[model samples]
Target: MRNVAICGSHVKNFISSPSFVTAIEMDGVPIFCGLIHTEDIKFDRHIPENRFKVLVRKIAFSYNYRDKNLIFTTAIKAALNRFYVVGSEFVGEVIDIGSDVTDFQIGDKVIGNNHYPNSGIEGVPGGLPSNNSSTEYQVFHQIKLIKVPPQIPDEVAATISIGGQTTYSMLRKLSLTEGSNVLVTSANSNTSLFAINALNKHKVNIYATTTSMRFEKELKEMGVKRLIQIEPNSENWVADELAEEIVKEKGSFDCIIDPFFDIHIGKLIPLLASGGRYITCGFYDQYSSLIGKEFQYRGLTTSEIFVTMMLKNIQIIGNCIGKTEDLQNAIQDYASGSLNVVIDSVFSGKQVGEFFERTYNAKDRFGKVVYRYD
Candidate 1:
């Protein structure tokens, strides 16, 4: 099997091996580095009655922002003689099943169920099918996978599991009514793009925030009423003329869906109307390099944030990747033409470096960067 992995500062591919190791020297220190690669993962040919093994001959996978932290942490563990397979979203086909497995067949396409907290089945442990999806083979419980309908393409299916589940979960928490004024921060992110597409069906006045307007037309087509541009490294929402004007015209947002609370919460709290809701799924300062380099916004203090939320009755909610039904509903919406995944690019063959660069460092990336293992 062939797989792509993160190596120190480069992306590389290598064939499956019993023991694989790579390291890079920096400042005279040898640092072991690699995350997400194929391995000779062993599985019983006589599978457990409730489990199945997938011979993932082809896979389309993508990265989430959280992978940055995973990459850094996994490298540290790699030095300690620990091995980890890391990837969050992907789609694959099953080629083998347990004798008792009845719901899935050898040729069915599937995505991770990702049911959080509990796997729903009594004995099947689950959070994600595996925290690792980049590998070419995996064993999963029947409850840990969801069959994908034929209408959804591989690229879209690979990217949908995390973004779609989280988006639908956050929207459920917000529970905004029709015609409500809603703000979606980090609007170009995969989760936010999914939110925007899902929100288009809600008949709400959608306001999105981004550092660039490069995708302005596409966002508008996705039903964003206004796109507010902010300084890349600053949290000066009040100083942004377009943001201020929108706030003045709309009074205040009825709900806010933010991807990064550490960056947006202080700047956006004052914009939440009384009894409004503020929900966030994740944050950006996940890796060590970004430590102590938090965004700076003027005038908003911790005391003021508390006061604003208290006085306005704002509901601040935190969410993780959602239930199995959320992923199912998202796929159903996609099949019905009510929702779509926006893919920035797809890579294959030896474009490993370019794929990782576009996924992690592209300033103009507007959607998911996918890798198709051919």
Candidate 2:
């Protein structure tokens, strides 16, 4: 069987330019990378009872910051590492099922876990996906799978499993209501876009930050009135200049939704209103871009953080993936045409290398970038 997988034990060295494993051929046919190493992976024919093979045909998986951090940020110097398939979500059809499986049939369009909960990033290192989802087929547990509504687009269905759930869970915790003021960073992110869509009905005043004005039109459509644009590389960025600008323009935010957790935390904490919540999913930048280093955002002295927290009476919340309930809600909203999933672009299987490249440098992507299988 052909599979495109991450090399856990082997790291590819890019001399002039970085490289990625985007293609693979099954059996004797050189589908992706030239072959002849069947000994590496013993294709097991013995099927597990609760596990099943899903021919997602086209896999729509998002690259998490944590994964890139390990691979690129520190130049792949993670203290503890292992070999396993890499991906967070999978969208496709179940072509085969186990003996005891009754929830799925031979051809059920579905969505499910690509790996153990939050393992694609920081949930746990050991629980990587059994099948790297970039392949044509995957073996996923029945319990982790959900049936996609006929109304949901394949691309939209593909994007939901991770970003959707995260947004749903975060919004529920923030408890936005009319007259509430909220702040979100990386407004163009899939997670933030979904949160903004959900908050649209709440009539909450939304404040968003973007590095580029290209997303200005998109943010406005999501009901964001005030947009904050900052340069992490700028000398004044870490000086809390953006924080002060936020106060003057929007005063204080009731909730701050931040997935890109880095040195900006110190700047953001002061911008929160009394009893406000600061929520985060991961520190994506520290791992992905080795470019201009931002000032110390995290790792503040205990006294410095404690004083800020006490002064504002702010609550710091760490959120990983959302609960099953969150996925269900997101799915329902998508099916009902209430949720809007902005797909940045679609790439073909032949463009696998370019797909990863686009994701690495997401230029002008307002939503999820989908890779559709033919």
Candidate 3:
């Protein structure tokens, strides 16, 4: 099976033999990907009597920021000899099923469940279904996959799991009331897009921040009440005209949803209302290459942050992926036409480099970048 993988400097120590190697470059860095032959798994011989497992053939996949960090860091890991297959969100077909599997059929369409915090099953660790989803074939427990409804297109299904799950999970934590003033940072992000769409149903007053107004119309259409455009080079949010505008109009935010806490925490915490809630799922400076590079806090110290939170009775919440029900609810919303996934673009065949560039480096990208296998 041909899979997209990160072949480190010592790849030969990991992959004993690959059928062929294909080199692709992104941001001037070489990514080694290739086709490899593997012995077919005999389901009958491998299936456990008590556990249900399914063999899936990947159809399409998408990148998350986490996946991007994983790829780049794995490429440069000093002692990492294994070639890591890079992808998290994917849509696939169930090619085979174990005898105990009753929830899926041989031809069912599925996406990873990615239940987190708890998998609800004994001894089953909850998280992504596979870190190596770029592989053409993979085996997963039946509980780790969700059936995709016929109404949701393949591209949307491919990218929906992480963003949808995380958004629903974070919003559930916030538990905002109707008409609550909410701020969403990194507004062009997939999670923010999903949050905006879901927040529309909650009837909240949504204010979003972006570095550019390139997708202002689209964001408004998604029900963002106000779009605050900030200068890319601006360091001081206290003096930023756009930031002041939000403060003038909203007074203070009742809740703040941020994708990167490290980038926005110092700038945003001062804007939260007394007793407000701040929720974050991730940070931008994840990999060593980019760590400490985003200095947006303007010298805001940890002591200051704690002081503000303590005086205001503000709550800071950290969220992981989500419960299985979060994904289920997102899927239900999509099926009922109440929610949608925003896809920036799709790539197929051998457009590997283009996929990575569009996924990671495209300033104009406002949604998920997908790669489909033929």
Candidate 4:
């Protein structure tokens, strides 16, 4: 079975989790001569205060488990058990079927989600191995599969399971209203572009931000109401010289969606009108804590849209996505052509590591970079 595992060796360099190590300690020793005791202790290379942050990390993982059907690991020693079958979302010629299978047969084209094969839960896995579809012949229960729609392409459909789901979850959290105003940072990103197109049907006004003017024509074609050209040194918290011009025309966004976390969260608050929403799913950089007093003084609220913290009445929400449903919604939108899927370039799968590095660094390019497997 040739399944792709995000091997721990590669994961350590990119992962945020500190390595888990073994150590011994003495607790409340009352003159016990020659007594040695051992207990597991945490040593986070990322921070000095590991325990306090551990609670936050655990809470975040628990939230992801509920929302996205997978876990995000920060532990260097934790095994890389998270994965999905490559062909699950695309229609494939079934090579085999279990004796108990009822809904499917060999040579049938199918589309479905990847799940923990044994436990039968959507994202929760029983103590079973995850590699399934990567094999020459793989088998799964009929109940776990969904029929693939004939209309979508395999490359576009491939991302629906992850990208679409995530975009939907974030949008839902934003609770956009009819005629709402939106500011999408990194407007050329796969999710960002989808979001703009998602709200295009509504009477909402969209202000798309990009680092280059090259996207102006493309974004305009996608029906973006406005485009804000951002320089490499653009600051979100401090008012730019162009801030007045933007606010004057668009009246500031009712909700702000950022995917790359390129826009500083602290700086993003001021870009919103009073009681406007600010939501994001990915933060590529470490963030400074939100200044509540600054928000209070400005009569604005702040939030991080994880599943755990529910923000009501404030209008701003932070959302993270990891689920099959979210993926499906995104996929459906794309298939219908309402959402535009723009790829900057597609590289061979072997170059995926460098692809991500380029994505993370944003060296020189525009649009989403997809890695295709032959």
The prediction achieving the highest TM-score against the true structure is 3
Ranking by TM-score: 3, 1, 2, 4
Residue pairs whose backbone atoms clash in candidate 1: none
Q: In candidate 3, residue 131 scores what lDDT?
A: 86
Segments of candidate 3 deviating more than 4 angstroms: 8-28, 34-41, 78-82, 231-233, 238-241, 290-299
Cα RMSD of predicted structure 4: 14.5
lDDT of candidate 3 at residue 49, scale 0 to 100: 51
Model 1: per-residue Cα lDDT over 128-162, one tens digit each: 77666776677777778889999999999989998
Residue 226 in model 3: lDDT? 85
- Pairwise TM-score winner, candidates 1 and 2: 1
Better of 1 and 3 by TM-score: 3
Candidate 3 per-residue lDDT, tens place, 70-161, comes to 77777666344556778899999999888778899989999999899667777777999888888888888888999999999999999999
Tell me the whole-model lDDT of each prediction, alpha carbons only. 0.77, 0.62, 0.82, 0.47
Q: TM-score of predicted model 4?
A: 0.58
Clashing pairs in model 3? none
- Give the top-scoring candidate (lDDT): 3
TM-score of each: 0.86, 0.77, 0.90, 0.58
**Candidate 2's TM-score:** 0.77
lDDT of 2 by residue, 32-72 (tens): 22111112222232455333333334345554444444334
